[model samples]
Target: MLKKVLIANRGEIACRIVRTGHRLGVATVAVYSDADRDALHVRLAGEAVHIGPSPAVESYLRSDRIIDAALRSGADAIHPGYGFLSENPDFAGAVAAAGLRFIGPPATAIRAMGLKDAAKALMEKAGVPVVPGYHGADQDPDFLLGEAGRIGFPVLVKARAGGGGKGMRRVETAAAFKEALASARREALAAFGDASCLIEKYIAHPRHIEIQVFGDDHGNVVHLFERDCSAQRRHQKVIEEAPAPGMPEAMRLAMGEAAVKAAQAIGYSGAGTIEFIADASEGLKADRFWFMEMNTRLQVEHPVTEAITGVDLVEWQLRVASGEPLPKRQEELSIDGWAFEARLYAEDAERGFLPATGMLAHLDLPDDLARVDSGVRAGDRISPYYDPMIAKIITHGPDRTAALSRLSDALAQVRAAGVTTNAAFLRRLTIQPDFAEGRPDTGLIDRHLTELTMVHAAPPEVAALAALSFSGTLAARKTNDPWALLSGFRLWSGASDFILLEHRGQPLPVSFLSKGEGNYRVLLEGRDVDLRISSSPDAFRVEVDGRTSTLHEVHDGKATTVFRDGESWHFTLADPLAGEDEAAAAGDRIVAPIPGLVKLLHVAPGAAVSRGEALAVMEAMKMELALPAPRDGRIAEVLVSQGEQVLEGAVLLTLEVEDG
Candidate 1:
């Protein structure tokens, strides 16, 4: 066995590798960038080395630095845990040059499947089915336009070097073909440093299925079945499950055999996945699926496959890289149950899943029945420089239905503050009618976006608890006046003290009555509650309906008052007696959404555009978002240009819309 293994990655994946390393009795080494000095993965590993600066190019993507880290740590092998340098074939060669084992496929395998166009050619020769479209090398604009016409309308322009939907466009009309090609190429260049593209028939209502194929040094390869990852947003998977529901065994065997053959064709070793795009228009027939590219490393959703198959892919990777034979034969490998994996993101699902950044005030998850693989604990910061995925929640049971139920229960009880998240959104998706039926396709989320994206309404009991325990600057009045003490409390008679506070955008109030000084029974919601207060320093706790709510705030007489529920809620102790308003500013230029490189700016200044027109496109958080104009307008200013890296909220372009 390899004595020490260096993980060339960050976040949960690095942490995940360390976990298996410990189990296998292999010392794990972790390499981190400056931004990840205090990251969880660094602490989890047996040893850690600082690679370089935060920008991935300076650190994680630097093959030399990764090799140096492995050498310095005395690790016998390096595991490029997905993304960064996982699929970079040259990096594999560099690692080999350093005389260290790369715990993945040989360099040949990565190179073979590196580019979509090249891979399609190879797969076709290997007798694997490929999508019908243009995968030629002609990049001339006129040639691409001709190809689009040849392929017919409703074709997909995909980056020859792209994945995660970063550099892909589905052009539904001939008129939009040229624009889509330019946009796709720009993102392709920005994301993969390759502007080459391919055109394919866009299979409507497709199911994104990928097979988990594993191989050992002995030329033995077997597949662990398929994962239905059709539930996506912008070509990025949000939820994935194993043994795709309603999947025909004949199709499974065919796809599995193809995946194994594809791996063996390139002399593949270790854990890799072969992704296939299947046309589900007719409900998952055997003949409709075609090769969609391959992820040449352990996948993010590997745990779901592991849960159902009772196999540890990481252990297999380590075992294979250590010159071990196949752990199990093809006949021995079989699925036992169903599993589901939900990607927990630190994003506002309601706000178009906008990546959110903040301190994770509290992070606690349920037991392992709902296995959570997370990189950060409470008080960790969600950085803007990396993927916004906070954790992966995996569940397994006898069937898909039970697995989904466990996922729902696990999500609801996870309490988090300081940033908005998709926890509620995920919880809602679990109960969705279509989702419960296990018939998820790539467009499932988009079709039910409005319902799935709704923000959850706070429960009345939680609201009651929040209102009763109020805080803030207790008003500027009664600094020296005795009546100031009466502000939050009522007198001896049956009366009420109204307190106003703001939570989200709504105003809420709580009423209470005073029984005595420093110690009194306050009338709360038709019931008298015991309130103990220290006159010198005011502090109290209110227990109601079997729940305890803590109150923390300064009694500032009367002015601005702040209170805490799950988060802080502030109120004006004194009524403003008047309201405030501001003039509406024009909403222009679909903002850059997030910090990333500008892929394409579709409209120039002074150009006329229509409502819902594609104005620009940006690549961020490893996905591409096309910014569309909300109304007909004349392009006023394109604040950015292609290939420019920008910050979040920086204007990409502006438009002059006529206000009626």
Candidate 2:
């Protein structure tokens, strides 16, 4: 085995690699940018080195700096954990030329499958089934348009060099083809520095099924079953599971064999995934699947494979990189049970799933029933320079139904504040009728978005509890003094104290008259509730309407947050003595929701725009967000121009409401 391994990445994947390396008695080294100086991965590694500034181009993608750090730290091998430089064949070759082992596929294999166009050609020659598309190198707009017509409408114009859905767009008709092509190319050039693209026939109702393949230096390769990643948004995966639901023995064998063939065609070594887009309009069958693309490194969803097969993929990467043979043959590997992985991201699901950034005030995750892979703690900040994924919640059970149930329960038990999250949305998605029946497809989220994204108001009882916790009334009950016990208590006259709070832009008053003995009568919005409250180390038990429930609360002075049954609410304390000011009217101004660079200005000052028209485009966290005009009006002031970096709530422009 290698003596020491340097992880050339950051975040949860980096932390994951360090854990496995340490477990195998191999010292680990971590490289970080300026933003990740105090990151969890840096703290977990045996030795750490600062590479460059926070921008990924200056730090994480700097192969020279990463190579130097590895050599300086005496690392014998380098593990590029999926992203940044993981699939860059040039970087792999650079590391190998520096006398350091690259813990991934050989540079030739990476080059063979680096570009989608070239890789599909290679797969077609190797007799691996590929999707019908245009992979030719003619970049003229007219030529591409003709090809689109040939392939049929609803074609996907994808960047040949892109992943993570950055430079991809789906066109539904010929009328939208020109605009979609220009947009896709613009994003492609900005993201990958390559304006070239490929056109593919869009598969309706497709399921994203991928096979995990491993290879060793001894020219041996094997497949570790497959993962069903059909649940997706914005062309990115959300929930993934192993032993694809309703997968038959014959179909699994066919996909597994084709995956091994794709890997062997490139002489692939180490860990890689062969992703296939299956036409599930019918059902999963051997002939319905076609090759999509091959990821030439470890995957983010590898944990689900680990939970089901009892195999550590990182361990296999290390062993294979150290000149070892394949750990097990194809016949020896078999699935044990079922597993699920839900990606918890710091993104608001209600607001178009825009990424969020802030300091984590409190984070409480469930244990015992699930395994959490996280690179952040309670106090860490979610920076704007990186991906906003907080953690991967993994659950295992004896069957698919049991595993899905455990995953639903585990997501509910997670409590976090200070940054908006998709946890609530994830909880709703898990219980959807189609999802429960294992009938998820790539269009599942988009098709049922209205029902899945329903927003619920916080109950008045929850706000009352927050008020008690914030005012120290809940903690004072443990005191010995008689006066403290009766702090908020009133006599027979029935006097009540009003606690003012603001939630969802509305003022809520909670009136309470304590009866002592941890009992109180609370009135909120004209509704009365009789409750008894008690506190334990982990949660507060409240009995209301003859029903008792346990809840967790976190307060950060600015916002008091309460979590109950997989849902959360934030209430900001309102000043009772101060006079309230008139709220600002809507559609007056447009502001940025997150810090990002203005990529384009679609409207100039004094330019008239219709309601819901795209006014500007902002790039944040590597995703482009279109700032739409709130109403039919003219742009009053253009506060920002293209290429300017703006902070959250920084007004990009204002609109002068058009007279009716």
Top TM-score: which candidate number? 2
Q: Write the per-residue lDDT of candidate 1 for residues 114-135, one digit (tens) a residue.
A: 8999999988888888999989
Off by over 4 Å in 1: 140-152, 457-461, 472-489, 494-500, 503-620, 623-660
TM-score of every model versus the real structure: 0.81, 0.93
What is candidate 2's lDDT per residue for 1-660, written digit by digit as tens? 999999999999999999999899999999999989999999999999999998898999999999999999999999999889999999999999999999999999999998999999999988899999999899898889999999998999999997889779999998898899999999889888998999999998799999999999888989999999999987889999998988888999999999999999999999999999999888888888999999999999999999989999999999999998988898888899899999999988877888998888888776766999999999999988889999999999999999999999999998889988889899899999999899989999988997777767777568888888777786676567777766655556654677788886678888887766677788888889889988887688889888888888887767888999888888898766654232233466889989878988998888988989998998877678898888887889999979898889899899885465
